[model samples]
Target: MCKITSELNDLRRPSLLVDAANCGTEAYQRRRDLRRMLRVAIPPTARAALEKLLPIEADLEKRRRMGATTYSFARHVDILVALLAEARAFRAS
Candidate 1:
């Protein structure tokens, strides 16, 4: 799977794993494969949200070309930490 797909999988796993109906678990069972989410339902908000990754990907690619080792391992925990912080602020408003 591509890095984008893998990362999206990580982002999706928690809620998606629990929502069998949303994921079309039965329909894609035989065709179970990477990015299977594409074969079934992709949440209405998902497209716009995922489009944000393109810029992030481009930034990371620039870092890659510049030989930045740390960029290769952007930990999800760190991302989640930042996301939670933003989420908290969003909730406050």
Candidate 2:
């Protein structure tokens, strides 16, 4: 998981999950600072890919609601894994 997420999780409850950012208390303010830093640090080329997570989250929620699969949450974990891989690639480059 991302460092930001790891730290944030310790400050709150269950590990932060996509579509569950609103779960823990003070989620709004707690995430604000980290988001501010990310807005500045994230590469422009990667911004589009990150933006696409929103639609994907909606899709996951839809699947969960319709009982499309028992692994919808697992898919979210996969998404983070893929993102971490890409981020590692960025560092290597």
Candidate 3:
């Protein structure tokens, strides 16, 4: 005899067992992906904004390379957030 399973059966177990979404690492990876996506989406006008922003990140990377203090990375991250927010706002307008 052939049998069929229902979606109701699929939901019978606790959700935590069924959910496969990676949270912590997935979130970090997704943030990186969003940043990459934004870089690809930038227009010529916005490239100026990105160019202004990239120096801070480059400085942070330089510091990391030279084994300097990590505190400065936060500022770079903040600038990236602000740049992305401005881009999103521009798009929303």
Model 1 agreement with the true structure over 38-80: per-residue lDDT tens digits: 3444323333324443344445546645777766433322223
How many collisions per candidate?
0, 0, 0
Candidate 3 lDDT tens digits, 1-93: 111112112223223322321122223332443356345544345434444444554565567557787645444455445444434444454
Residue-level error in angstroms, candidate 1, position 39: 27
Give the poorly placed runs of model 2, Cα more than 4 Å off. 1-44, 80-93
Off by over 4 Å in 1: 1-44, 74-93
* Least accurate 10 contiguous residues by lDDT in model 3: 1-10
Root-mean-square deviation per candidate: 15.9, 13.3, 16.7
TM-score of 1: 0.29
Q: Give the Cα error of residue 56 in candidate 3, in Å.
A: 2.1
- lDDT per prediction? 0.37, 0.42, 0.42
